[model samples]
Target chain A: MTAKPKLAVWKFSSCDGCQLSLLDCEDELLAVAGAVEIAYFLEASRAVTSGPYDLSLVEGSITTPHDAERIRKVRRQSRTLITIGACATAGGIQALKNFANVQSFIRSVYPHPEFIDTLATSTAIKDHVPVDFELRGCPISKHQLLELVSAVLNLRKPVIPTASQCLECKRAGTVCVMVASGTPCLGPVTQAGCGNLCPAHDRGCYGCFGPAEAPNTASLAQHLAVLGQSRRDIELAFRSFNANAEAFRREGNAHERE
Target chain B: MASKTPAPADRAGVIARAALDELVALLAGRGYRVIGPQLRDGAIVYDDLARADQLPAGWIDQQEGGSYRLVRGPDAALFGHVVGPHSWKRFLYPPAQKLWQAERSAGGFTVTTAAEPEPPLAFLGVRACELHAIAIQDRVFGVESGDFTDSGYAARRQAALLVAVNCGRAAGTCFCVSMQTGPKVTEDLAYDLVLTELLDDRRHDFLVTAGTARGAELLAGLPQRPASAADLVEAEAASARAAVQSRAMVPGVADLLRQNLEHRHWDAVAERCLGCANCTMVCPTCFCSTVEDVTDLSGDHAERWRKWDSCYTLEFSYIHGGGVRRETAARYRQWITHKLSSWHDQFGSSGCTGCGRCITWCPVGIDITAEARAIRDAEGS
Candidate 1:
């Protein structure tokens, strides 16, 4: 038998929910453990293993100067680097800081502002280093995370859906919250996954999975305005978990000025 | 089967609206899994029903482009509302289904084909336009077509029973009148039974007509009253009033779309189009699907599954190096052209049933009818 692939899980800055998703794959986690050598995953193990890792599952954004530099070294050492979840792929909720003054925020939130070292903007892994693939969500889904791992190990393209969330909602038989009861939903612009949860519960999607393939955020913003959403409401909606994603950032910026 | 001259026009009778429960019981007893419309997730959606009371009895939907609202209806009419987003196609060709499962067996592998068997279905409250959509799908999925057919779809569609409900009032988005498909379930369409709900201050009843011999047999077993000439007149008036369609499809759309293949209006539509697959997912007639093959982590088991796919997605058109239609403009053009123009070349009939679902369910409220007209008007200009 060939050598088991070396897998590494890296974190820069995040709540670590995305890393938890891999651990959440209870049955699949055991199988994954047997299939590959988990060289590094501080979330599950602390015994440090040095890279070059065969596959690096990166979580979180480049929030600090150190992290921006650290990602470059990680990328150089790994054969295939996949950024998982919105934080690593689209800058996560921490990227809300991208819009405002980071120094002022530090002064307000911390007692010793000088000790808090951070960058002016919370940015994605791709902003610093080239990403081979991005598996998106606020905290990435367990199934998608597994598919990404399996596909990467086997040298195949992951079967992750890049279509808008509306496809899954319709397939799950959830009525359109936007059309059905005039709810302002981001499902039209958001990527599929997250189990199509929001609309199933009668609430609008908060766009945790970020922009889907060829998302026309401008068109959706206009539709949201027609649905009676305020420009600020529209801005905030797009500036959620996946705020710093390219398509969503541009849309939120478009609304913010107005 | 369509050649068996149209159904008897005047062969109808009246049954109290509450008698639908008895009919449900009868169908359920006959090993058919009965399904009907119910108020679910703020809209009327097709779901499993054991009793007719599960129907959206006193609710009506006010639907328009990108909007739908379920309001308390004026009266106690079961089939008061027109078709909602959920259509009969979901049951016939489900969104996702396992095609085959393979398991490791002694040095080789053994494969089990087809998903688990489902009982025959009985769909209640099927609108006339919906019936037309089903007939269109039959040509694509059933043995009725001379060429390729899905064996599973053919089997499920053949065994399913349709109990259609004629429209008494049209929704603002309805254009079935222009499509020449609805306001009434005309003969030549396959349905076990057809009903036109009649509501008044004095009584609430349905004028039921049997389209097939099975429908006649079921009607014979049910409690019903021979229709009075007045009842017949009222039923005719009800369907006639439903012909008041607020939207209409332009005639010769197949030719017009073909002529305007490079029309600039498509660019205007792409500007508003989200490229979301909502319209195709809601459309009863859109039948494109893609397959996926997966293996367990142990590599002991593998399976193939088919899921509904739409042309709006770049992946749907992707081949080899990259996606064929890279721009949103091209994808939108491809969808409309296939649905309107090339569909005729393929299917010998229009693919659209004028259900107006695509219009109402679009995120940006892009009207297909209005788009077609814009292109048609641009021709003269």
Candidate 2:
């Protein structure tokens, strides 16, 4: 019998919600355990037997000097590294510091500002190390994570779609929040995932899944203005969870307080 | 079972407001899954109807570019709302369908085509524009028009009944008057049954017309009175009122767009176009699709499925090297031009029915009629 492939789950500066998505697999987690050896998942197993993992599921952004250094070692140890969630893929909400003064933020929020140790800007894993694949969403969707794991095990390209959220909304029969209600929605510029939760519930998308494939953010920003959103409001919307994602960051900067 | 005395084509009659329920029961009893519009989550959406009461009898939809709202009508009139985001194509062509399923056997893989007959569908309250949209799809999918027929689409489409309604009211986005597609169901359009709701202070009834033999067969079973001269006049007036709606397309947009291929107006439109695929997804006649092949974890079972694809996406134009229409400008140009111009050369008719779904459902409210006019009235191309 062939040896089970080694799988490792790693975290750098994330909320660990993405790792929980893997555990949230439940029955699928059992199937995954049977397929691969859980080599060094600190969240699930204490037993660490790992030199080179066949696959690595990474969560969180590189928010510290240590994270930047540590990610390279992870990339070296892993055959294929898949970054999960918005933080690992887009720098998450913490990347909001990229636009403003991080030092001033530290001084205001922390009493001992000198003791704080963090990078000036929280950056995605791809910024430091090459990523084989990326799973989008604030906390990665469980079904997509399973598809990624299955695709990796089967030696095929993952079937995660890069289509805009508008496609998903249309497929799900959810009315377009922006079109039907004149509410400013990011579905047109955002990637499809999260299962149409916001739009189906009559709320506009919060862009939890980051920018879509070839997103026309400039066009979307102009329409947002027409929808009665101020420049600051449009900026804040783009600057939310995916503040550092290139397409989003560029549009967000375009509408900055100036 | 009711006697099958097929009434002559275009035979008009009046069905009372209360007899609408009987019609639903009759269709249901005839083993057709009757789908009709009803208020859902503050918008009129089509769904399975157990009773005619489920129809949004007194509700009306106010639709403009980037805005839609549902409110109660001044009077109780069934089929008051215009088309919402849900097009009848969703039921006919379907968003996703399994083409084939493969199973791994000990000897070899056994494959079964996914053409299992679907339940017969009866669509109620189909707008006049929608009837035209369905006929357009008929040309796209029917064996008589296309070289290769989509068996799956053919099966569902053939085994369905289209109950259309002449528009008594039109949304601000509607331009059917210019397209010559609707506000009235013409004799050429293939609809089983068509209804014209009559709502005055004294009368609450529908002027019904059967366009097909089966429609006549179904209508003969239901309780209705012969259409009086006054009832016919009222029905004609109702449709005329809707046809006078202000939003309209230019007389020769197809030729205008062909002449102004390099017009900078496309770039202007692209500046506001989101390229989100919402317009195509909601469009009744946009029939592009992409397929996916997936297997289970065991690798024993595999299935190939097709889902609706849009020209606005980069992947839709993807080739061996890269996407041809990488810029949103190029993609938008391809979509609108092909919809209004190239489609006529390919299908002998315009792809758009001027349903105004593309306008009202656009995130930016990009009106095709206005864009066509801009291209036509350009200072210099």
Candidate 3:
């Protein structure tokens, strides 16, 4: 019998919610362990195995110079590197720093700004090194994480969708909160994955999954303007979890203090 | 299958507003799970209905671009206003469905296909445009029309019994007349029973007409009176008024959209488009899906699930390296063109049923008819 595949989980600058999603897969954790060697997951296991790992699931954004160097090493050691969550794929909510002065932000947030070793911008793993796949979400969906892992282990392409959240709302038969209640929903331009959460709760989407395949953010922004959303509101909407993402970044820049 | 043919007007009758409850009972008495529109969460949504009291009684919806509200109607009429955001596609297509499951055993992985028996559904208060949407979906998923038919959708659709409601009033967003799909339920549309709610100061009744033999049988069970000439005239007038009120139109939209792929208006519209895909979600005919294989952490058990997907997302057209429609403009153009132009080539009809849910539901109030007209005007100029 062949040896099991070695799996490694890595983190950078994030809330650790994406990695926590893996641990939160309480029912699947044991079975996943049985299938692969949990070589290096500091969050889940104390047991650390040196890499040249079969598969590395990288989470979080590269926010510091050390993280930038560490990711390169991780990429070198891993046969297949998959980025998990918005942080790894498109820079997480911390990417809001991309718009502002990092030095000022550090000084504002921490007492000892000089001690902080950091990069100017929080960026995705793909920004520094190549990624085999990028699973998009704020706190990535546990089901999608499972699917990505299963696909890698089975030697198949993961069938994660690149569609908008609007489809999810429709499929779930949730009434259009935007249309029916005049609520400003971002589902039309946001990617599908969070299972239409905000809309089901009678609120607009916060765009946790980032920009969909071909988001018409400009049209949506204009529509938002018509809906009595201020320019600041539109800018803020585009500057959420996936703010550093190209589409959202461009849209946000368009709405900037020009 | 013999019941597929149109029944004569002899099957048509009138039912008092009070006796409408009996119709709900008769459908429930059968194995069918009756579904109807009910006021919930500040909007009218389709839900399980065992009694007539659950219907959107004395309620009418005011719908426009970026606006919707539940308002009081003239009387306690059950089916008031036009279509809501909820459509029949939800029940037929479903949000998420299991395709198959696999479990590791001593021999190997054992695969079991999903075979959960779905209860027969009786869809009450279905609109004419909604019926057209269902028919469009039928063609898309039916074995004869498409290369591959979705067994789940096909099964659900086959077991569905449609109870259509003829539109008496058109919402500001509705343009079903332009699409020739609504404001009136024609006999050829395949609705089992069609009800035209006739409400005046003096009377509140339904002019019920059976379109098929099964409908005729159901009508026979309910207490009814022969439809008078006045009732027929009143029913005709209601649909005519709805048609007149719906001023929004996109005449020759298919040809216009097909010819103007490079129009600058696409860029203008793209600027405003958030690409959130609200229009596609609210749209009844937009039937795209994606599948995922989920396993237990133990890795012994796995299930393949399919969920609704939209074209608006960046990854929908992702190839080996990157997505084809990378620009928001390209994506927006793709959606509208596919809905209006390409749909005729693929499905032999426009994808849009002129049910302005996309307009009203859009957070930014982007009207498709207006876009089509703009494209046409640009091309002409």
Candidate 4:
């Protein structure tokens, strides 16, 4: 009597981390299958169910002309579109390629540059098509993924946290690695969901959860400088996986180049 | 379900040793496993408790900023140490958890969720601060927005029997009193039973109170004496002493940090920070992480996993073509503000617990308390 909800998983240019998160739900994988119909997921299954899907999870950045055109098709096929991970929500690590010349990159990587079919810049899913919900994380947290699925099934807004990672650290009773060890951490400004993993292993945060609501990144950067990190060091830190993100890129560019 | 509080007088002057044996038997009888601190690998760590003899007695530990050492106590007393590096988190979150598994099948492909194990447990000697930490986690993983959702965690939490122990001696890194969470268990309803250790020159007894029917049942099976008014006075005095001895100070800190969100102090601290994610690792509450996938040698099957990640990592903040907090300065600024100021707005509480672990464990020794103090002084100028 009840129709099974149709689900689709889409990918662009990425490391496949976010889509992998869905499959990573090893314990809940079968339950998820029973809850919904898998309309499309190139990574998980060979069978493809044509859309007007109930739910669509989009991953990776739009890095080529074909990718830009493909996202529009994905947008048309899905009723509710959710972008997963840094590549889909933001442009992702590959967005760092946007800083340099794409033509040169293609030429260097490939002997024949003319064979390359790529765009000038790497961009997020929102840059190409409308996104209903944007889940923040390099590889989105599986717990959050489960919540999104549940919220979607219930037809309610997901109650994902908008606060910073610092709250999570405090809740976990971890000593501030930054304050205690002068190990520069990004938890104060980064969003929560990673389950305080880095701090648990006696390491500082590296901003994998992206920016929290209304982050004060400028102030934290100044504090790190006072603790004795160099400007080049600071710049390098920000320019890592998320270097292509607008906020981090802007700040990193302002720093003195070593 | 919460339990009813039993009469305090009915559960007084109970020797701690006898109570331990009784608790172990009660847990074993109830079809629950018991785990507590034990001496292993030259350190006190969490392990299974087979009987009362497995407990660490007459062993006290000396702890200071950035250091911990086990030392012999004047008397052979179990449960003398404040806490170890490992908490209850290891059992719940686990260092590694397989999210799902994928196998190539005749019908194209199949993905299966990992089998979940619901293990019932009884934690012995849970301190007030640790209890607070668990409560905080309850708010996180128990909700829809939280990064982790484990029915197993919920089931274990629901079935576990909490026996809260009030801290009588302060570890050098402890500042729970400053955080206003310990020395005396204010949220007595959170636990099924509470024990206030009564130590005098001639006697060592614990004042026990049953919080639920389960606690009452456990108490009825034990031998106890009526608590005197003097015993209550002594307990209050012990708590007061801890509050005074607290070393952390961040007066009006959350509000102050919120008011000066654009201050230049954070930039200074950024220079020394490595963004290595050590702080988040050591922090009891930092929960940000990443997901990973690995394939079998034949490449026919693949499995996915969630690994811990940090905001300090450059790729974590990427958006569009770049990161929002580009400099370590901005990254550090974002981190401190969220902890001391923004966290209050979101969680209705300051993120920092005044635990000096961050200061002591930091490889470079960046003090959070001092950071707030500097901010306060800067605002004044």
Candidate 5:
């Protein structure tokens, strides 16, 4: 019998919700453990193993110089590197710093600003090294994580849709909260993966999954304007989860305050 | 299971305004979960109907791009407005469904296919456009195709009892007249039962017509009177007004869209498109899906599931290396071309039923009819 493939999990700058999602896979964690040897996961296991790992699941955005160097080393050791959640795929919510002065932020937050070692911009893993796959979500769905691992082991292509969240809402039979109630929703331009949780609760989408394939953010922004949403509101909507993502970044930039 | 009873001759008649409660009771008595349009969360949506009082009796909805509002009508007329955001597809083709499950034992893996649950459903207030949408899906999922049959969809569709409502008024976004699917219920596309709501100064009643044997049997149980020529004329007028009220028309749009694949309008539309897939989701006939595998942490149990997907996403066309439709313009082109043009090649008809849900529900208010017209008119110029 062949030895199991080694799996490694890494973190950078994030809330750790995406990694937590993996641990939250209450039923499927054991099956995943059986399929692959957990070589290095600081969040889950204390027993660590050094790489050349077969697969590395990277979470969080690269915010500091040390993280940028660490990601390169991780890529060198791993045969297939997959980015999980919005942070690793797009710069995530921390990417809101991409629009502001990092130095000023550090000074305001910490008493010793000189001690803070950081980069001006938070960026995705793909910005530094090549990624085999990128799973898009604020807190990545546990089911998708299982599919990714299963596909890798089976030597087949993973099937993760790049469709908008609107399809989920439609299929779930949730009424259009934006159209029906004049709520400003980002679902039209956001990717599907969160199972349409917000719309089901009668709330508009916060765009946690980031920009779907080629989002028509301009049109949605204009529609929001017609719905009585201020320019600031439209900008904030695009700047939420995947703020540094190209499509959302461009749309948010368009509505930036003078 | 409810017995399929045959009906006596002569089932066409008028149901009294007060006897609407009896219709609800009759459907419930047959063991069907009665579903109809009710005002909820500020919009008319399909939900479980316990009694006739649950219907949107004195309400009418105004629909347009980026707008929907419920207003009190002149009288308590059920089924006064056209279609809403929710459709019968929700019941027939659910968003997410489990296909099978597997358990890893010491010996090996044990796989078990999910059993199909057949729950009897009676759909009230189904519009002609919605009926056409259901028929379109039937062609895709039904056994007659012999290609790939969705057993879940087939079972749910077969178990459903359709009660159609002839549109008395059309929303501003409606264009079923051009699609030739609605504004009027035709005999060939037979529903189990059809109700044409008639509200006038003199009386409020429904001119009911049974299109199938099942409908005739159901109608035989309710109180009614023979439809007079005046009543038939009144019903015809209502449908005519709806047809005339339709502003957006796409008479030969399929050929126009097919020929203009490289039109610059795609780029212009793409610029405004969020690639959010609101159009595809709201569209009653758009039926793309993706499959997912989920396993429990124990390494012992796993399940395969299918959920709704859209072409607007890059991953829908993704292979091993990358996606075929990487750009937003390409995705938008694929969606519109598939719905209007290529759907005819795959299925024998256009995928769109002209319910205008896509137009009304779109966050961007991208009018499909306007986009089609722009492409056609540009070629003319």
Candidate 6:
């Protein structure tokens, strides 16, 4: 008898969109279930299978001390751990906490700051544990999720693209919005996987797939300035979903002085 | 199973009317919904077409960086344009698709999950570049991610027939040749049937080639002439001219970009980039999206929906109360790095397809290809 590949889905400080991406595979959900043993998925059911699981999918960022410790346990229990979504891979949106005082944010959001138990900074899963693969996106793409799971199960490398959204736009036969419409877009710098939604709907890219293989963001920024975008606007664009990402972080810092 | 097997080097043109009429009948006969470009509200849109009359006949478009204008061609021939604003995407990953619907019943709660429906289709006047776009997206949706699975996307992709039209004229912004994806449908493997339009003194000739059993089956029902060598030569020459005319500015930007990550040039562009996601919406392959679950009037029922999201929005990066990318500079950096660099680490292909939509749609008209060149030039300087 062959052993079914064990699958586990974990969460942290995130919008749960990436984890939900797994569930969003409605058509393939049943097929996926048939392919693997559902060891643990708290969002789906109360039936939690005990670990030392085959594959563990961790979502969200490390925000609390307990969460930091818990991830270590997860790391020890799982043979292979893959972080999904922007939060888990690059401290997510919560990595914004890395810039500001967490206490102040807690005080502003919650009436009693003392009631909250959190670390000063929200960090990525990679900061604390070794990750086999890091899937990038504010909310990870469902198709990418399926591929990631399949690749891990097969012990093969996932075939995700490493090009910019601009390449995708070109392939789609779309007239250059920046050239044809003079619309400010991040397609040149953004990673692919979102299926070029914004451009199809008559909008520019917002860098949801994170940065591309070799992003010339500064050149894009300068071009945007020539087109009339203010420094503030350029600065804001750099501080998005994968803000803590080193390249993006450095670019944002340069704008602060300006 | 196919009647006429053209060699891999086959090239030809068919009569326009015969091709359209045959496609319409074949689609209707096969339980497929026919959709093609139609003149609607002053722009060419993908809509349901009942007959050949429904297509944009004798209409050509003049497209430049930041502008689009429909022009009358020399002849009243339909399918004269290279591409319209709409692609095959509207039918696949629909703008608004219901992810899951939840309704409360007596016992506890009844949730209804709808699967992606496969709607067979017959798409007419699909250009070579457009085919390349669909093929690239095939990797993203069909192979790379495989999430948001639409039996509809797969069905339409497989079951639906493509009547690829070779571009005889190149728009100023058209760079399919530079990207090496088009002008001529070199890789005929992608399409079931390929068409090249040849213009003579009186009318046009469409050289048709069938690559798959399905295409041959469909072609058998149509009135197609055996393509003569002259017909094939004329068609090939027309497409070649367009390919040569449409050259991308930076041919090796992808590799050059990979070499200069921290060249201190991004700061120059960040000054003016608004970080608004306008370029992404018009792009065909920017597939980054976010999902949201909401409750109706009563909190008892909840529904989940996926909406197109941008990395430019602050809320997109919201963690706890603040955004991770608090500054636009970092956000910009992250976007370019992932597209050209890290994407290689994830998917074996480049994330971009070299579409210049970002340049045209940018309100300030920032050219991405130009930026890559500038950065490269700066490195050399």
Highest-scoring model, TM-score: 1
**lDDT accuracy of residue B257 in candidate 1:** 89
TM-score (all chains, Cα) for each model: 0.97, 0.96, 0.89, 0.57, 0.88, 0.58
Share of native C-alpha contacts between chains A and B (below 8 angstroms) recovered by candidate 5: 0.69
Compute the lDDT for candidate 4.
0.71
Model 2 stretches astray by more than 4 angstroms: B1-10
Between the candidate structures 1 and 5, which one is better when assessed by DockQ?
1
Q: Model 1 over residues A68-120: C-alpha lDDT tens digits? A: 88999999999999999899998999999999898899999999998998999
Please write out the lDDT profile of model 2 over residues A38-111, one tens digit for every residue.
99999998999966999999999999998999999999999999999999999999898899899899999999
- The digit string of per-residue lDDT tens for model 6 on B1-381 reads 122355453433254565667678777878878888877534466778888788887887776555566779887656676565566776656644567888888888888877755557777777776776776667666642457555445655666666677778777667666666677765543667777777767666577877666776676777666777888788778887777554375755556767776667787666656565555655565666666555532335666766555675555676897888766566666666565556556655555554555554554555666667778789854
Over the stretch B1-381, how does candidate 4's per-residue lDDT look in tens digits?
A: 354565555455454557668778878888777878877533466667878678777676555543456678666556666676556655555545678999988867789988676557777777777777766665556632446566655666777777777766776777777676675666444776777767666777777776677777777777776667887777777666556554665777778888877778876666556454545555555556565565532334667776555576565686798777777777777777887778778667666665455555544456677777888889844
Candidate closest to the true structure, highest DockQ: 1
Model 5: CA > 4 A from native: A1-7, A29-39, A49-55, A76-80, A150-156, B1-11, B99-112, B142-155, B200-203, B291-306, B317-327, B341-347
Per-candidate DockQ versus the true complex?
0.74, 0.67, 0.48, 0.03, 0.46, 0.06
Clashing residue pairs in all predictions, respectively, total 0, 0, 31, 117, 14, 135
Question: Model 4, A50: alpha-carbon shift in Å?
Answer: 44
Judge candidate 2 at residue B85 and give its lDDT: 87
Per-residue lDDT tens digits for candidate 3, residues A1-258, read 788889999998888999999999898788788889999999988999987999999999999999999999999999999999999999888888889998888889999988999888999999999999999898899988888888888776776676677777777777777666667777777777887889899998888998876677777777678778888888999998999999999988999877
Worst 10 residues of 5 chain B by lDDT: B1-10
Candidate 4 on A2-50: residue-level lDDT in tens?
9888999999888998899999999888878888888899898999888
When sorted by TM-score, best at the front, the candidate numbers are 1, 2, 3, 5, 6, 4
Tell me how far the alpha carbon of residue B89 in candidate 6 is from the true structure, in angstroms, after superposition: 1.8
Model 1 segments more than 4 A misplaced:
B1-6, B104-108
